[model samples]
Target: MLYDITHRTTYGYGSDVSVAHHLAHLHPRELPSQQISDFKLSVEPAPTVNTEHVDYYGNTTTFFTIGNPHDRLVATARSRVRITPPLLPNAARTLAWQQVRDRCASDVLTPDSEVGEFRFDSPNIARRPVLADYAAPSFPKDRPLLEAIVDFNGRIFRDFKFDSRATTVATPVDEVFKKRRGVCQDFAHLAIACLRSLGLPARYVSGYLETLPPPGKARLIGADASHAWFSVWCSGHGWIDADPTNNILPGDRHVTVAWGRDFSDVSPLRGVVVGGRGHSLGVSVDVARVAE
Candidate 1:
């Protein structure tokens, strides 16, 4: 499947007088199951300097600076990409969850271990006994890794309510667990925390999920929103992505953008402004399918 994606971000400030700098992670990733054909990013006020590079996690990072003063800012990214469904291993045939956790733990002692990096705490996700306890039911004695992860993902979908107003980006994982309600970000974070607490290697995935409108309703432009999901490492399978908010494994409809320990590492757009204050943010995303 091929798709064209548009992501637009607008910021209005109470007052502005000076410079601004921004960093963006809006470029679609080129993966075995996904290919990026084209990508373009445009910034308003005409940045004095604009550049891009791949980050430590292999995500395309765009950085730009606006020297002139402006009360408003707009950054938009457009891309064309093709996606194929990823092959997944049989959940019941994979190694036991405990074995994967033990291997990850042993591997963490090695210096510069890549997989070990995600098995620990980050700014947005922390391992706690409560999280381990919450995840306990899904992981029984010698349960297969992928099978257990699927059960945990489904449990999160059934237990939590998808209330946009229930939490913010800064909300803690324990709080989300307590309230049993939050948007996609919260659920993804919650799942990561739980898995990390169990000593498993997991990472956060940032991307877009294609959504369909009602039976007779026309698809609204910019109706799609950014999506978040989690991935767990299976010994022979590498990383397998799962969506707890929707309780399914990620496939062709999911576009990969960036990934890291948590959301803070791969925020679609974030920055520092020299003079802008009392800012309000608006974001819209459209993911349209292309017929062959």
Candidate 2:
């Protein structure tokens, strides 16, 4: 599958800004399941300095310095990517999950992918007995690690709610688990935190999911925004994709842009500026699932 993605973000400030430095993770990388054919970023007001480098986790981070005096700033990123991922049978779930967890436990931990700050001690996700209990159980001693992960993922899907307004980025993982309501990002975070609590390495993923409408209904634009998921390291399998939001493994329809230990690391854009009391941010994204 191939896709054309256009993302535009605009910031309107209450006062003029003197200086601004921004970080962007909009570039796509070639993974086991996907490849980046072409990508680019453009900034309005012409940045005084712009540079990009690959982070330790293999994600591209772009830095830009804008000295232009303006009340509003806009940044746009556009890309075209080709993805070819193998489709594993649903029955393979349990085996795949176990494989990923075991592999990650053995290898694939770099300084970048390592869990830095321990949020588990804060009672966010660690306090949840259910998550802890699930992590404790030894499932299918003879089963592959991937399979175990899939089994755990299915349990999460059945137990949680897919509520969009239930939580924010700052919401505690324990609260999210108790409420069982959140978007894909929340679920992904929860899953990562839980895995990390169990001493396994996991990473956050940001990308677009190829969505389909109900029978006879037209597809909606912006109705489906870019999505968030997670990956666990497996030995021979490498990093395996898991969509806790849907209790399924990501395939070709899952277009990955960037990855990191947490959302802060892979945030689409974040920055600090010299002057701006109040600001309004507007984001517009278009992701289309096209023919091969």
Candidate 3:
């Protein structure tokens, strides 16, 4: 599937900002199942310095600094992407959850052994017994990794409520557990915590999810929203993406932007400004499957 994605973010400040610097993970990274083309980034109140570089996990990151004073700022990204459904080995054929965890835990580490790092705590997700206990029901003795993980995903969807106002990006995963509610980001963090508590490697994925209108209704221009999900690495089969908020495996409708230990590693746009106190922020995202 092919997609044209547009994301715009605007910040209005009560006071002018003397200077600001920002790092954006807006550029889509090339993956085995996705291709990107015709990508562009635009920043208003034009920056003095702008550059792009690959981050620790190989995701493309762009940096820019605005030296002049400004009361308002806008940043936008446009991209054309082609995504193919990721393939997975038969759920029943994959190794048991315990065996995969043992392999990931082995001390014979290699330079490419980044997966192990995710099995520990991160800036947002913390490993705790509560998380492991939540994941326990999904893993029966010798359960295949894929089967167990999918069931876990379903459990989260059924148990939690998706409420945009229930939590913020800074909300703790444990609190979210008690509330049983939050947006996609919170759910993604909770899912990551659940897996890590069990010594499984899981990464937070940030991107877009295409929205289709009802059969007889017209599509709203900017109805789409940024999406967050999680992926678990299987020893032989590779990574599998799942969305607990929507209770579906990411496929044609999902456009992956970046993956990291958690959201802080791959926030679409984040920065520090000298001033800009009492600011208001607004964001709009649109994702459409382009015609052949």
TM-score for predicted model 1 compared with the true structure: 0.97
What candidate 1 gets wrong by more than 4 Å, as runs, is 107-113
lDDT of 1 by residue, 1-292 (tens): 8999999999998798498888999999999999999999999989999999999999999999999989999999999999999999989999999988877777455422458668999999999999999999999989999989999999999999999999999999989999999999999999999999998888999999999998999999999999999998888779899999999999899999999999999999898888866899999999999989
Candidate 2 regions with alpha-carbon error over 4 angstroms: 87-130, 136-140
TM-score of each: 0.97, 0.84, 0.97
Model 3, 123-216: lDDT tens digits are 9999999889989999878999999988999999999999999998899999999999999999999999999999989999999999989999
Identify the superior model by TM-score, candidate 1 or candidate 2: 1
Q: What TM-score number comes out for model 2?
A: 0.84
Give RMSD (Å) of candidate 2 vs. truth: 4.0
The digit string of per-residue lDDT tens for model 2 on 1-292 reads 8888788889998899999999998887787667777788999989999999999778888999999887888998988888887645444443444444444444357432334333234333343456656655534445556766787778778878998789977787778877988988888888877777665666789988778889999977766576899876654445678998888898777889888767777888899988887999888777776676
The top-ranked prediction according to lDDT is 1
Q: What is the lDDT of every predicted structure here?
A: 0.92, 0.75, 0.91
